[model samples]
Target: MSDLLRLLPWSGPDGRRCYVSADSGGGPVSRLADRLEELQLDTGAELLDHVEELLRAHRVSGDELRFCVHRLAEALRDALRVAESRGRRIPVPEDEMEDEMEGHPEPPGLC
Candidate 1:
């Protein structure tokens, strides 16, 4: 969705703007969850609960929730990439990285 794209902060990498793919239908959450499940990663109901809390905290609508979910999915992908680059196991937990992956705080007045 364009709204999601607008909300995202863009950065240039190698002189090219990097952006995450959008999920107009909000499908990325389940897709990411499925991937995690396939890898025997934790995709439990508890995490879903946290996601719901985050959406509510941010006043995210169903459609907007899709964007947030997709962001998280991207974060996970990045984490895996970092691990792979270091010749370590995929999905390795890194403290600061985890905080970033958790996403930014809801904008003022959102809650």
Candidate 2:
């Protein structure tokens, strides 16, 4: 959907990052990748809630903390990837760039 390079939601067979070419983003693979991104984000959110509740308990063991940390790391990686994929698709407004070019980065004292 963007002219910029697009990163897909999955890795390659060798565990390398995967990318897709610019297109209308309506292909079956694209659709599946989008769905996977949604699921990844949902899982990350659920992990966050579980971490909060688990931390609230007073009797956390080293093993429990280790497992939670491992899972949290995974969720964080998914969230970062999703953020990067979505961020690349965001278009910069032409007018905003024009305003910056004119040296009026922000109107008067609205910094």
Candidate 3:
């Protein structure tokens, strides 16, 4: 494993290891905020409200919440990349694409 992977908490059943990316450790809400800032999105308040709802629904612990936030952030980043590659405008709301991503998994192709 690379040095960065070595730094992650990698533990699971039967001595198997699960590596959480550095970004994933930051939780979903924070991740979303960071992505929005990067993309210069205008709907920060709406996105934050959605994240808050999710957090409340999950009632997740701080650490677990952070992981979820990170995943959401990464998902947003991936979505933005897809949009950009297609020559579409970014900062599209997560609600607009969340259903699509959930229903249609991306091929294991290179970005």
Candidate 4:
């Protein structure tokens, strides 16, 4: 018997993180979470494209920009949580990784 739990992407209205117990992370609910995460990431990408186009326009209203940013942030949070539940880190660019590692070398023998 395993008591492992996976964190769901969305939190409760009370601001508490929600979790679902699964013997492994491949159960039905886990699969649903994975799908939702993918959808969120796709939505976020679309929103980013919209933001880029809006920025290129001669004039974009403050409210429109704010709404786009808020939605994009929400989608990003969902995608991040999904990755975390799967015990994976979102891939970072190699240059960014090197910058992060600078002055933060891994302990010897602990690669």
Candidate with the greatest TM-score versus the true structure: 2
Q: Model 1 Cα displacement at 59 (Å)?
A: 4.0
Clashing pairs in 1: none
> For each candidate, C-alpha RMSD in Å?
19.5, 8.9, 17.9, 9.0
Query: Model 4: which ten-residue window has the lowest total lDDT?
Result: 102-111
- Candidate with more favorable, higher lDDT: 1 or 3: 3
lDDT of 2 by residue, 47-86 (tens): 8898899889978899989999999899889889989888
Of candidates 4 and 2, the better by lDDT: 2
What is the C-alpha local distance difference test score of each model? 0.44, 0.76, 0.47, 0.71
In candidate 3 the C-alpha lDDT for residue 71 amounts to: 61
Q: After superposition, how far is residue 69 of candidate 1 from its true place, in Å?
A: 1.3
Q: Stretches of candidate 3 above 4 Å error?
A: 1-54, 88-111
Residue 105 miss distance in model 2 (angstroms): 28
lDDT of 1 by residue, 1-111 (tens): 321211112225543333232333246643453364344334434455678788679766787678668756855654554343223212435695468548666322200
Candidate 4 lDDT, 64-92, residue by residue in tens: 98888788788778777777766633445
Off by over 4 Å in 2: 1-3, 93-111
- On lDDT, the candidate that comes out on top is 2
Task: Give the deviation of candidate 2 from the true structure as CA RMSD.
Answer: 8.9
Taking all chains together, each candidate's TM-score versus the true structure is 0.29, 0.77, 0.30, 0.65
Q: Per-residue lDDT tens digits of candidate 3, residues 65-106?
A: 786677668656545543443232233467975665577653
Give me the displacement of residue 46 in model 1, in angstroms. 20
